[model samples]
Target: MNRIEKRMQELQQRGEKALITYITAGLPDMEGTKKLIRAQEEAGVDVVELGIPFSDPVADGPVIQDASYRSILKGTTLRKVLAMVKELRAEGCEQPLIFMMYYNTVMSYGVQNFADACVEIGIDGLIIPDLPMEEQGELKEALAGREETVIIPLVSPVSGDRIPKLVGDAKGFVYCVSSMGVTGNGGQFHAHVAEYLKQVKAVSPIPVMMGFGIRTAADVLPVKDVIDGAIVGSHFIQLMEESGYDTEKAKEYIRTFKTELNA
Candidate 1:
């Protein structure tokens, strides 16, 4: 099993929730991204979603969009981000690292080639937010031999009848979008979020991780029992921004957040 599955299984055995974090690969500069990933792991983040910067991140909110744009301006390409992963692995960082990219980038990079590169570099999974369930066939074929490299599917609150199908073939813990919007922090979560998550958990045999608008630890407490874990993204980017890209400070903040979540 890849680290993603292994970590989830380990968390399940311990009766503890997983803490998955996200950051743009080239944000605050390239080298800073590497340090940020390591900081997160040290601070109790279970998995790291390394977001590949894209020219047009349709699913991203303003904050993530700004970060992506900055990374792009710094000339952060997919190739560079993968190189960073290789460097981290060489340095003995075994944190489960997954790529979160848009489909257009994958298309330009050649899907099979991208999948093979992920396998070669020890990447656990790929989360293409814009990749539709119906279009997963080619990517699945590309990832055929590499069971360790998975294509993680997403479930939205408005997924309706599609939730079962998405989670049925889900690889890592299913990422269920907590609200019906692009990725951003401090967005309003509705009362039915718990009910929506309950439905997702009912269908998903694997762990269900709720993302989108989950900023604080308290935000996760209510649905902690209803899901396996919570995915924090834009809020983390915001935190890093506030810290002026000081990863050490970010890690300390995350440690505090974990305490609050557990309490």
Candidate 2:
């Protein structure tokens, strides 16, 4: 099993909710992004979702959108992000690294090429938010050739009858979008989120992880038993920005977040 699969299995065995942290690559700068990833792992984050900034990130909220824009301006391309992952591996950071990106960016680089690149760099998985289930065949075929790269699919509350079909094809895990709207805007977990997670978990053979609007341990605690993991993005980005990329403060914030979740 890959690192992602192993981590999910371990979390499930322990009966604990895994903490997944998201950050835009090359945001603030490459060095800062590396620091954030290391700090998250040190803080007990089970997975790290690295955002590959694109020109138009439709599913993202203002905070992530702005971070993507800044990252792009700072010369954060797909190649650079993969190279950063390679560097991190060289530095001995073993946390599972999953890249969150749009379809356009991957298409621009070509699916096979992107998958090959990720595999070479030791990336554990890919989360293409814009890739619909119906259109994932080509990328899925390409990823099948790589041992290290697993493709994760996102399921939203509005996915309706397609949920089972999507979950069946999903590898690594099913990323359950906590709401129907964009990220960061959903203030609290809806009743639908819990119900949806239950349904997804029932059908999904792999682990189910929820993201978007999961800002605090309090926000995640109520539904902890239903899902395998909780991912916090906007909250962590806000903390990183507020800290002015101070690595120590970023680490401290992640430590606090982890402590609260495990408390």
Q: Which regions of candidate 2 are displaced past 4 Å? A: none
Q: In model 1, what is the error at residue 238, expressed in angstroms?
A: 1.1
Query: lDDT, candidate 2, residue 100?
Result: 90
Deviation in angstroms for 226 in model 1?
0.2
Give per-residue lDDT, candidate 1, residue 31: 89
Write the residue-wise lDDT of candidate 1 on 57-99 in tens digits.
9888998899999999999999999898999999999999999
Model 2, residue 110: distance off in Å is 1.9
Backbone collision count in every prediction? 0, 0
**RMSD after CA superposition, every candidate:** 1.1, 1.5
Evaluate all candidate structures by whole-model CA lDDT and list the values in order. Answer: 0.87, 0.85
Per-residue error for 215 in candidate 2, Å, reads: 1.1
What does candidate 2's lDDT look like per residue over 135-165, in tens digits?
9889889877566888888989888788999
Model 2: weakest 10-residue lDDT segment is 185-194
